[model samples]
Target: MRLLLKNTKLLQTKEQLQTCDVLIENNRIIAIKTDVESTTADQIIDCRGNLLVPGFIDVHVHLREPGGEHKETIETGTKAAARGGFTTICAMPNTNPVPDSIDRVENLHEKITADAKVRVLPYASITTGLQGETLSPITELAKQNVFAFTDDGVGIQTADQMLSAMRLAAKAGKAIVAHCEDNSLLHGGVVHQGLASERLNLPGISSVTEAVQIARDVLLAEAANCRYHVCHVSTKESVRVIRDAKRAGIKVTAEVTPHHLLLNEEDIKDADANFKMNPPLRSEADQEALLEGLLDGTIDMIATDHAPHATEEKALGFLKAPFGIVGLETAFPLLYTNLVKTKKVSLRQLIDWLTIKPAEAFQLPYGTMEIGKLADLTLIDLNSSEKIDKQKFYSKGKNTPFEGWKVFGIPKLTVMEGKIVYNNL
Candidate 1:
């Protein structure tokens, strides 16, 4: 298949946004120029001077297949991702069989291959079944096609266990994407330990719970010399820890979710489960720190942590409901609307965070629009505005906190591997 994109504003660099035409042949970009004739390809798309950027890449997402299809599947989740302009996503290994063994990993790969509309890279658990007691076959699993190792949703509690896992991952040359949390500091908490939890009379999760574990992991990572990534960074103190580690030349990278970057604890208007998430919404001070972290390069990328759940599960209320909200369908719009449109960050910087930054962090090759690269790209309608309606979401999970929020930067078209997968123009 050959496709031509014309009259598009190509996002080339932080300061060089220029109009160009792109030609894709089969699965790679063949040419990029200021103008190309319409008869050069089988299909020609007039971008109408809209933004043409690399397809968004998410390093953290939860496609609840194998065990929890009630929430989401590879097919449904990737479809949602395509609508959000993402071409590649990484799946967490917290499924039915947990993907701790080679057979389980192979089984999950089969499902992804048969059902996924976009690229889905799966992670293997750092510990056996994410139990935190025994280490999974890290050396063996690293030989497989998994992107990295993580025990998301639950942090490895013991220092010795985590240290052993980090050493193994370092030896195998795979990243240890950690869900940093000190369970000992969590006293049956559900939300951030602040005014919101106090007013709602709910148990609160302290910032120390996340920061302490991150501090410990950074020290361990420096010693192990491993590629370490922090997931859903939420606290000011955690950001400080990561910033210091990077200055000290540690191989550390971190991601901040859109909700964490845009909403704070004060933004939680009521005791609703939609506003609840792990490393819960923090204070205004913490939100400011997150923004600074993102702008100054302490944070490496933006990940959706795209956890989804059934509506009834989330209807259980703030204290009793699970800790997550669907994000894959809303991340780009929210960031572009709040950050880029408001001038908090440049449009090129935002694109790098969603695309090249993640690709560089994970060592993946899908976030570039260069010639000879994979043709994964998206077109954006930056001038349009739309309210976020959950019913319009492609994923089965409609539990989002951003319902009814007006946002710009809507995705108009999505192409993966030189094939048009979605078109909203």
Candidate 2:
């Protein structure tokens, strides 16, 4: 399968844009030039002056396949991801049975191959069954193609337990992704511990609940000499911790979500469950710090943290309801519309964060438009404008807070390995 994309503006790096024709043969990019005639391909796309980018890669996503299919499936979730311009998504291990063992990891691979339209990478659980007491088959799971290990829904509460796991992961050369929550400190709170919680008369999750874990995990990773990652970073204090860790030469990388960057406690009102999530959104000061963190390169990448819950589950008020929202379908538009189109960040810089930085962090070779690379690609319609329609979501979950967000710049087409997987047309 050979294909030619014409008049494409490709983002080569944070500060570079290379406009050319990207010729792909089978699954790898073969040529990038000014004028490639249509005779050398099976198909030729005009591109129509759209940006041709390496497909977006999200390091954090929840597919909910094994048991929570009522909320999401690899099939439905990846469809949403492809639509959001993502080519590869690293799935969380907090499934029903959990991908803790090698067999479970292998099962996820098989399921992804059979059901997913986009690439579905797995994260083996850091603790077996996520009980936080016993370690899963870390080395064996890593050998079986797990992108990283994470007990994402919760952290290993015991310092000793986490240290032991870190040692093993370090020895095995695996990336250990921390959910960074202090469970002992959590009293089943549903909002950030701040003025909002005080006003609403609700229990809240303290910023320290996430920050303390990050402080400890950074030192632990430094001690163990391992690649450590913090997921869904939401607080300014936490960002400061991560920045200090990076400056001191620890293998620490972190991700901030679009919602966290754009919305905060001020945006939540009247007990809306859509605004509720674990490590609940913080204040304006914290949100400003997050934007600063992203702009100055203190944060490594952007991820969706695309957790989805069923409607019945989310209807139980704010405190009793599950914490999450649908993210895959809305991430790109929200990020591009808010960050790039508004000039908060350069377009090239946004592309680099969405692709190259994630590729560099996970050691995945899928985020470049260079020749001989895999042809995972996203074509954007920079001028398209529409309101978000949650009623027609591909995933079973409609738990988004961004419903009717009048945003523009959506992925008009997404192609993986030279095959058109999603086309808005």
Model 2 Cα shift for residue 347 (angstroms): 1.0
lDDT of 1: 0.92
Q: In candidate 1, which residue pairs clash?
A: none
The reply for model 2, stretches above 4 Å from the true place, is 12-19
lDDT of 1 at 225: 88
What digit string (tens of lDDT, one per residue) describes model 2 on residues 250-335? 99998899889889998887798988987798999999998898888788899999998899988898978899988888888888
Worst 10 residues of 2 by lDDT: 9-18
List the candidates' TM-scores in order.
Answer: 0.98, 0.97
TM-score of predicted structure 1: 0.98
Given candidate 1, what's the lDDT at residue 331? 90
Q: How close is candidate 2 to the true structure, as a TM-score?
A: 0.97
Query: CA lDDT of each candidate?
Result: 0.92, 0.88
lDDT of 2 at 363: 88
Error of 1 at 192 (Å): 0.2
Model 2: per-residue Cα lDDT at residue 175: 90
